[model samples]
Target: MHNACLFLGAGCNAIHRMSTLARPACLGLLACLLAAPGCYKVPVTGRAAVNMVSDEAVIKVSQEAFADFKKRYPVTRNRAYDQRVQRIGERLAKVAFWDVPAAEWEFVVLEAPDQINAFAMAGGKVGVFTGLFKIVHNDDQLASVLAHEIAHVAAKHVNERLSQAMAIQGGGLIVSGVMSTTGAGALTSNAVLEAYGLSTGIGATGFDRKKEKEADHIGLIYMARAGYNPEEAPKVIENLEQANAGRAMPPALLSTHPSYPERILQMIDLMPKALEIYRQSSQKQAPQLVK
Candidate 1:
């Protein structure tokens, strides 16, 4: 009887000690699992994605981020380049052909001569840097890059990525609760969370590579439908490959994207379908190109 009392008392004492973080941790875990990300199908590819963020919230966040970016780097006012990009972008925008209702898509030309990158924001904001003209060659290649950037959003990669991060964080909290119950010290428990966090960060690259391949597959179709040759995609890849060749490279898995050859092969494999879309678009092309 005395031993049972002693054990019960000790158990109660341990629970009291853990109450600070452990109780809240348990509640946090319950809330996380109950409020798990909802799955939605992306526009063209139909890949089911788990994302907790609402469309309204996503757009709001994107708008804020975009505004900050523009403040840091103003849009170019060069009339000729702006008109040319707007022309091609408008055409490409018209033939985007995604199931998702397009956001009021906006295009901007950024006059950063040293910046060779282009990006698509989640809410359909796209920026193409002036330096890209050095290798883009013409409208078709530019279309290829734009299509690829928009495909990233069409595929819901950003939302899915956010979901992954939330899951990792939730998992860490759950584990912390378990550790607290096991009488782990704060330092030891924090160390475990840190280790798991490092692992989570590294694992994120895997999905990025998958999203890249998915974007490449859809981008080709988008550009083809916009009346550009699907073959132009491979040319862009070749340019990227040549540019990256001299630079030191990371291994395939650790890299955020596939190697140029891997990406080129993926585009090549999709060429037949993309080519058919191109032919159909060409048949329906304006009798005279848009002025």
Candidate 2:
């Protein structure tokens, strides 16, 4: 009886010690399931995507960030530029919203003449910098950019990216918590996080070629559906080649986006299909220059 009492006491003592490590590990495991349940298939490509974050949640996050952005970065006062974006956005929205509707859509041209970039977010938030006009030889190219950005949103890339981030963070927190109790384990956990650079905040998006190529394929369809020549898609990459030159490079393995040459070649392969769509669309118009 005395030996059994001693064994029970030892078991209780071990449980007390393990309780501290077990809770965070369990929470981290729970976090994995949080976003994993929210899977949705993409529209055009029929690709399956897991977006642990709900559309409402993603839209809320996007609007909050966009609001913060507008406050810090003044929007352009160029009426012509603004009108151009709105016109294109309206046309694209009519089609894209059918793919993935948002509660509202707003297109803003920010006053960054030297900043040649653009992005589209959930809830139909889009920004095109004036600097991008330098690369805009014609409306087709602009359509390519807009369609590509729209493709990203329609594919729910932001939500997928965020959910991926949450899963990683939860995993890290759980690992860190479990390992935190021991000197060697803590060192190992910190090393793992540092190696991958998974800090508490969102990290570099690490845009992969698969996503970029998928966007290219869908964007070609979108521009064609919007009455733009899908052939102009490659021309956009030629422009990107010019714009991205003299830009910084990460190690070849870690580049967030596909190399410009690679994207151009892939677009070439997709042109035939996009052209068919363009030829069939009733709204086809002569390519218009945005200058």
How much lDDT does each candidate structure score?
A: 0.62, 0.66
Cα RMSD (angstroms) for every candidate in the order listed? 11.4, 10.9
Model 2 clash pairs? 35-52
Q: Model 1: per-residue lDDT, tens digit, 63-142? A: 55556566657688778668877877777777664543647678888888877777776667778888777667767787
Best by lDDT: 2
Shift of residue 33 alpha carbon in model 1, Å? 12
| lDDT for residue 183 in candidate 1, whole number 0-100 | 26
What is the lDDT for 62 in model 2? 65
Candidate maximizing TM-score: 2
